[model samples]
Target chain A: MLAFVLRRLVQSLLVMFFVALLAFSMFRFLGDPIAQMVGQDTSLQERERLRVELGLNDPVPVQFARYVAGVLKGEFGISYRIGRPVDELIAERLPATLELSFVAALFALLAGIPMGVYTGLYPDRWLSKVLLSLSLMGIALPTFLIGILLILIFGVNLGLLPTFGRGEVVHIGFWSTGFLTISGLKSLIMPAITLGMFQLALIMRLVRSEMLEVLRTDFIKFARARGLSNRAVYFGHALKNTLVPVITITGLQIGSIIAFAIITESVFQWPGMGLLFIQAIQFVDIPVMSTYLILIAFFFVVINLTVDLLYYAVDPRLRVHGGAGGK
Target chain B: MNGMENNVAAPVADTAPALLEVRSLRVEFPTRRGTLVAVDDVSFSLRAGEILGVVGESGAGKSMTGTAIIGLLEPPGRIAGGEILLEGRRIDNLDYERMRRIRGKEIGAIFQDPLTSLNPLYTVGRQLVETIRTHLTMTEAQARRHALDMLKEVGIPAAEERIDHYPHQFSGGMRQRVVIALALCAGPKLVIADEPTTALDVSIQAQIITLLKRLCRDHGTAVMLVTHDMGVIAEAADRVAVMYAGRLVEIGPAQAVIRDAHHPYTRGLMGSIPTIGRDVERLEQIDGSMPRLDAIPPGCAFNPRCRQRFGRCEREKPSLIGQGDRAVACWLHEQGEGAS
Candidate 1:
């Protein structure tokens, strides 16, 4: 088992290396970052000075080595437009995004699975038909449209939740009494729903279809023949087999969520890395944009690796060797 | 048709009652075209400790009869008319939950294909323990011990060690043996083995058939053996029920049915078997096929295939008739004074 985890860790590093290289090259090699950063008003000598100062005149290999060394030392360099440390800016905005994204995923898992289970178990029933149809419509609707609709319903008309932004972070030593982080959670509800609604639908449909297929397998019949209750046959025998696909799709969807966060963050004006990424891009901030891209790629690869390991644990067919004892 | 009229006839005794009595059992399906009758007025009785072999060609409703008895038939097909009495208790059309309890407890089943019967993910021991646990309220250790004993009884080597092995680890014959162990784990009174050896090789087939017969005899359990092999019926069955076109044309003692078949269809079936010590010109093949459920022949279903067909055969269907030990379904036998 230790060997298995070590092997996975090694593969994850390889994946991250390629991702970081791509992020570095896409911003550094192909595009003229210094020309764009210096703008049209700079004199020829001024442009040369700026290029040398930013290490653009150095060889590509030297630049990459410096970038890797800086990354390893926890220094992401200064943003070209803001003239502040990228690490501090990201640190200030990171918590809200993490909380919102995690909450959205939690909501999706809690809501989508039951709906999928019900639809899969009773395909021809009226409730199943209605849920299936609604899920289809949900996937078709865009995040912005859904966000606007939610703001209109709950924010403007119902006057319940705040439409956007985070409340103050109260501090009492290390812990706060008015952890209105919980209250901030309320403000994030509408945008999180908009971000997670399509994923819920996509996940539900995949789960429902996969579960329907698993229900027809021989093991399920064997379980039924044992005279186990319907609930046992479904949740016990069928559900375990259906989980591999669900884990796979859910893992891949996290990558899509990172991509979707750009739009969601802009729509709701939530202070997060996605909004930071858009602002940096608009201002031609090479260091900030490269760091964001590499971080997103790193998250995607790490999430997929965790899911792959989980899949191996759950399915004996994919186990490293003979399972249990196989490292 | 005249071969099995005299030897080992069936006797109706007032003293011994049938442990499982099925009378006028009919199963039908509502297809898009019309109602299709799958089992038409099939009747048979089985006493405790007796092995009754049901023989027929494909699409003869043999498996359907087994499914109906176990209450496992899928939707669109249902019992149209029947009385399935187990220990004098009516069981036909019983509620699902009630039937489910009786299925693996009172009446266990071993299907033909062992590859598809057992769950691929679970170990054979796990399945055995599960079945035992469901039927009997035993502790996990108790169930495990019982399962190990059963695996040993079924002649599996290293039963304790192999209990943890998955289904894919065993060979076909070994898997079938595991299935038999599962079916017999509850000590069921009646075992429904539907073509249990049909999927096995010739050598393993004989071994499985002998094992089943020996197990039933020792436990005093009745077996409803469904197979198309007449040779197997002669070896393992106490009585034989011959079916064609979803109807029972002849049923009697195994010896009588093998040696002196009464119905034309039965005679054709016996004639088709290749005797080891005897040489014949050619094996007789039953002419034509069993009629489709939707397009059954006008009157008698076998009239088109029967070589002894007469003018009256086209106008009337035959029903089982007898008062003594044996019953035969044929117009020729009906004419005789003591033919049954």
Candidate 2:
């Protein structure tokens, strides 16, 4: 098991290396950062002096080496637009995005699984049909459209909740969380639902189809023949069998939730790394944009590694060696 | 169809009450086209400690009858008529929960492919323990010990160690042994072994059949062994039931049926088996396939395929005519008695 983990770690490092290389190219390929950072009135000598001090005048390889070294130490340089360390800016926005994504993920899992199981167990029931149809719309509708429609219904028309931004955050150490406040939670509902909608539908459909397939397998019939209760047959036998695929999809989807949170963040004006990344892009802020790219890639690699390990644990067939112990 | 009167006169295990009795049992699958009868008025009895081989061509509803007895018929296929009784208790119409209680406790099942029968995620020992505990009032430790004993009983080497291994770790034959162990662990009075050796290797098939027969005999568990292999039936079954296109064409003592197959379909089946020294160019083959559920011909289902099919055989379905320990559902037998 230790060897298995180490091997995955090495693979993850290799993937992160490639992403870092891609991020490094953005620095050289994108337009000059000095032009964007300095004013028109600044003298050519001042600009040249600033460029040298920032190591922009150095060879591309030397600059890339410096950037890689800074990334290794969790430093992503100063944002051209903000004039602050890119990591610090990310740190300030990280908590909100993490909280929002976590809540959205939790909601999707809690609701999607049961609905999937229900629809799977009774594919022809009236309630199952309705739930299935609703899930289709959930997958079909765009995130922004759903967000706007929800804002119109509950925010603009009903006047029941806030439509944009994280509300009433309380700071504890470096982490500022909206969980401690009611306004924060109330403001969270719309965005969390919007972000989770597509994933919830996807999880539901995958789970439902997988459940249907698992139920038809011979082991399930053998389980029933053993006179196991319906609960054991459906949940213990069929549900567990469906979980391997469910876990795979959910893991990949969680990565996407964090990466593609840009649209959701934009619609709600939620202050998070995604919004920061978008602002960085608009200003051609190389440090923040490249760092964000590398960070998202890191999430994907870590999640993929975690997923690979989870399969080994969940499915014995994937384990490298047969167990030597007995019950 | 008059099976109830002969319930007390089961050929084997004389004086023992019938362990399982099916009277006019009919299984149907309701499709959009119409109601397709899969098992039509199939009636038979299994005596305690007796092995009844339900032999037939594929699609003859041999598996269906076994599946029906265990109450595991897949959806849309249901026992549309008739009844099934176990030791005088009516079980065909019991509620789902009640039937589930009877399953694994009163009746266990061993299916064809052992590879797919056991859940892959769980160890073989865990599966056996769960089944044991479900039907027997045993603690976890007791169940585990019992499971080990079962694995050992099924001839699995290193039972103490291999018990923790998953199903895939074992070969096809060993897996079937584990399946038999699971089915018999709870000491179910009757076992429905549906095509148990069909999915095994040729060499492994004989071993599995022998294991099943020995286990069932030792435990005094009656078995309705469903299979299409006459060779397997000859080796393992004490009594034989011949089915064709969802109807019982012939049923009697296994030896008697193999020696003097009264029905033309049964004769055809027996002739199809090749002898070791025979120099024939080709072995005997049945003329036609079993009819589909939706298109089974009227009267006798086997008429289209029977070389000896007569006019009346095509007009009127023949019920089992002989009495006592033997019977044949054919127009020739019916007419022979009528003429005599």
Q: What DockQ does each prediction reach against the true complex?
A: 0.31, 0.51
Q: Where does candidate 1 stray beyond 4 Å?
A: A1-10, A28-44, A57-66, A72-75, A85-88, A168-180, A320-327, B1-14, B323-325, B336-340
After TM-score superposition, what is the CA distance of residue B263 in candidate 2 from its true location, in Å?
0.5
Best candidate according to DockQ: 2
Give lDDT per model, in order.
Answer: 0.80, 0.88
TM-score of each prediction: 0.89, 0.94
Query: What's model 1's lDDT at A103?
Result: 67
In candidate 1, how many Å is residue A263 off?
Answer: 2.7
Off by over 4 Å in 2: A24-35, A40-62, A320-327, B1-15, B277-281, B335-340
CAPRI grade, predicted model 1: acceptable
DockQ, model 1, C-alpha based: 0.31
TM-score of model 2 relative to the true fold?
A: 0.94
Docking level of model 2? medium
Per-residue accuracy of model 2 over A1-327 as CA lDDT, tens digit each: 888789988988888878877777765766787788889999999999988988888887787789889888978899889999999999999898889998999899999999999999999999999999999999999999999999999999999999999999999999999999999999999999999999999999999999999999999999999999899899988999999999999999999999888999999999999999888877778778878888888888888888988898888877736544221
- What is the iRMS for every candidate structure? 5.3, 4.2
Per-prediction fnat values?
0.25, 0.62
